[model samples]
Target: MKIGVMGAGAVGSFYGALLARAGHEVVLIGREAHVAAIRQQGLQLSSQGETHTIPLHADTSPAALVDATLVLCCVKSPDTLQTAREMGPHLAPEARILSLQNGIDNLAALRSLLPHTVSAAVVYAAVGLAGPGQLEHRGGGELVMAGDALDAAGFRAFDDAGIAVRISPAIEEELWSKLVLNCAWNALSAITQIPYRALHAATGIVETMRAVMNECLAVAAAEGVQLDAALWSRIEGIAERMPQQTSSTAQDLARHRRTEIDFINGAILRRADAHGIPVPANRMLHALVKLLEDRPGLPG
Candidate 1:
């Protein structure tokens, strides 16, 4: 299987390393520095208390995707359409694309731009780019994917690479559930610059998270997505599951790079406005993150 990972940052690099380690042909399309490092040495993957240097192809061009049978679209939310446009002309005729990103709209956005089978996977990994050509996996690497994009061969390839995947009938609800979890933690973690366990232990943190979760739930309900009633428990338990893991938003802020707040909490704000529902928690978080993005030097 020839697999290409677009926007191969932390998540993309982690999975690409695994698939390559499993003896599949994998190419990572990413930034120049990361790609250069991979081309020079190899992809350094640190996971489960062990580090391995996995040799794979890396390129800074979408043309790297030309021969790929499967492409994992892992770009940020804001870059979805533009990345799709760049990669579209380079993809194989029957290539399947999977969106392993945050937010609910990426799948539709990809389907809109590319003439290919595009599906989404609800990613449950706490991984990050430790440095150029380096990926660190804190914990959690399960994926819940849906749609007709992945055939049996594709699933088998992912399974052989040690990626935990399951098909779900209600992918939208899964996306929303992940969104709600992001809304609850991502911004707060970014602002505080702390991991989940420490953030959850802070004074008044539970109440704050509950308030944000309520607004998200209200927005989801208004949008007609019936999320799991026990989703909140799962959200709360993220701290216990990945205690040291910081949100990707936190990682972005720490790197002084752009974030997907616009798609996470900001997504809720957009829908709430459309439904005439107030989401003060989401609103405040979105604004604060935007403010930080604009003024990176500001103290939190």
Candidate 2:
């Protein structure tokens, strides 16, 4: 199978490398630095303290995606619409588009921008770019998608590549749950520039997280998504499970790049405003992150 990965950052590069290592023809469409590095030195993936160089095709142009059977859209939330528009004309008509991105609105955004329905994937991965064409995987690489989005052949391809893929009927609920978790961690961690464990270990931070989760839950309920009580535990447990992992927002701010906070916490704020829900905690976190975003050089 010829697979194309758009926005070949850490997540895209990691998954594309796995498919390539499994003997699939994978092409990564990304920045010039990454494309040049992969074309020269292959993709260097470091995980579990072991590093491997996986040879694959790469390009800076979306034209490379013309022949892909599947296109994994791995760009950040803010880039979803523009990226989709740019890649739409280049993609095969029958190619399956899977939004392997953050937040809850990317699938809809892509579907509206493109001529086809875009499938959503709830990604549970902690990966970051170590260098050009290099990825550092901390933990978690499972993907959850809608049952009807991928056919039998699609499922077989993913299974053959050793990817953990789950098909669920309640995908919207799952996406909302992930959004709740992001609301609890991303902004706070970004403001403090702290890892999960250190952020949660601070005095009153756990309680503050509870407040954030409560606000998100209220907003989710108002949006007609009823999240479970266990969602709180799952959100809290991420710190224990991935103590060293920092929020993507934290990494983005450190690099002076724009974050997905607008889609994460800021999305919650939008929903809350629509439903007349009071979410002071989420509002504060969202505003603080926005401040940092507007002034990237501000010391954390």
Number of the top-ranking candidate, with TM-score as the measure? 1
Tell me, by lDDT, which candidate is best. 1
Candidate 1 residues lying further than 4 Å off, grouped into runs, are 296-300
Worst 10 residues of 2 by lDDT: 291-300
Taking the tens digit of each residue's C-alpha lDDT, what string does model 1 give over 120-148?
Answer: 99899989888899889999899998846
- How many clashing residue pairs, candidate 1? 0
Evaluated at residue 255, the lDDT of candidate 2 is: 82
In candidate 2, which residue ranges exceed 4 Å CA deviation? 296-300
TM-score between model 2 and native: 0.96
Error of 2 at 164 (Å): 0.9
What's the lDDT for residue 51 in model 2?
95
TM-score of each: 0.97, 0.96
- Model 1 steric clash pairs: none
lDDT digits (tens) for residues 158-272 of candidate 2: 8888889987889999999999999999999999988999899999999999999988888888888988779988998898888898998999898888889999998998999
